[model samples]
Target: MAQSNKYQTGDQVKVRVDSPSHHYRTPTYIQGKTGVVVAICGRYRNPESLGHGGDGMPEQLLYRVSFAQNSVWDRYRGPSGDKILVDIYEHWLDPVGV
Candidate 1:
């Protein structure tokens, strides 16, 4: 497992989609969106199945990510509402470039 930079609560970050295995908290809609790292949720064992449930799996680290409603949807007619928070794994993030 790769060591993750210890992210403090409310640290802003950008998350990228690597691959959608079987189960992950990263929603398909936000795969390539830039968001803030809201909280560190600790490490979790990867639960992706290799079509047979026993191969090509790696341990994963989890984090809570938050994104503005306006940042996610262009035509979101609904009130911008509160930002959405997602529990994302480490493999799903990359540092955002300014």
Candidate 2:
């Protein structure tokens, strides 16, 4: 089955973990944190692991997730004015409906 390409930057999304045991690009602290989308980097079949052979679809949408610095770090010395950005795959996101 083909997935629909319907996501946009600035969209609110929730990152869900499909695998608990495997290491992921998403930090564990931000797994359940809600963030806003910053950018879209197209689609790819593989995750960004230098060791993992790149093999998958060419249509995976990549997105930049932005979270507040205070939300991610416990002892962040930076002012609340700062934020963090993480590049994640689209599969990690879902519509954040409260």
Candidate 3:
């Protein structure tokens, strides 16, 4: 069965700022940061569960999220248009207005 994606390209989303004791792939630097969905990278097995020696059932939808450089870093000295793209799982993201 195919999983339905919660977000689409151009959707605004915020990364969840969670610090779980278990293994996770979401980077801490991008946590709690807001970004726009640039692409849907399809579904894949959950890495966190795999890392813990559990069967990675229930794949997760992955999305390419884009964030403004200045928004991600307080002292970013790059152009105002500069942006960073991060591959984030659906579980780590929340819709900006919902």
Best by the TM-score measure? 3
RMSD vs true structure, all candidates? 3.5, 3.4, 0.8
The model with the greatest lDDT is: 3
Q: Write the per-residue lDDT of candidate 3 for residues 1-98, one digit (tens) a residue.
A: 76578999999999999989999988999999999999999888999899999888788899999999999999999998999999999999999987
Root mean square deviation (Cα) for candidate 1:
3.5
Candidate 2 accuracy as TM-score: 0.73
User: Per-residue alpha-carbon lDDT of model 1 for 1-98, expressed as tens digits?
Assistant: 46755565666677776665465556678888878887888766664544456653566678888988788888767677658788887777777653
| TM-scores vs. true structure, each candidate | 0.71, 0.73, 0.96
- In model 3, pairs of residues that clash are none
- Superposition error at 64 for model 2 (Å): 0.7
Q: Is candidate 1 or candidate 2 better by lDDT?
A: 2
| Winner of 1 and 2 under TM-score | 2
Question: Would you list the clashing residue pairs of candidate 1?
Answer: none
Q: Candidate 1 overall Cα lDDT vs. reference? A: 0.72
Candidate order by decreasing TM-score = 3, 2, 1
lDDT of each: 0.72, 0.73, 0.94
Off by over 4 Å in 2: 1-4, 18-23, 48-54
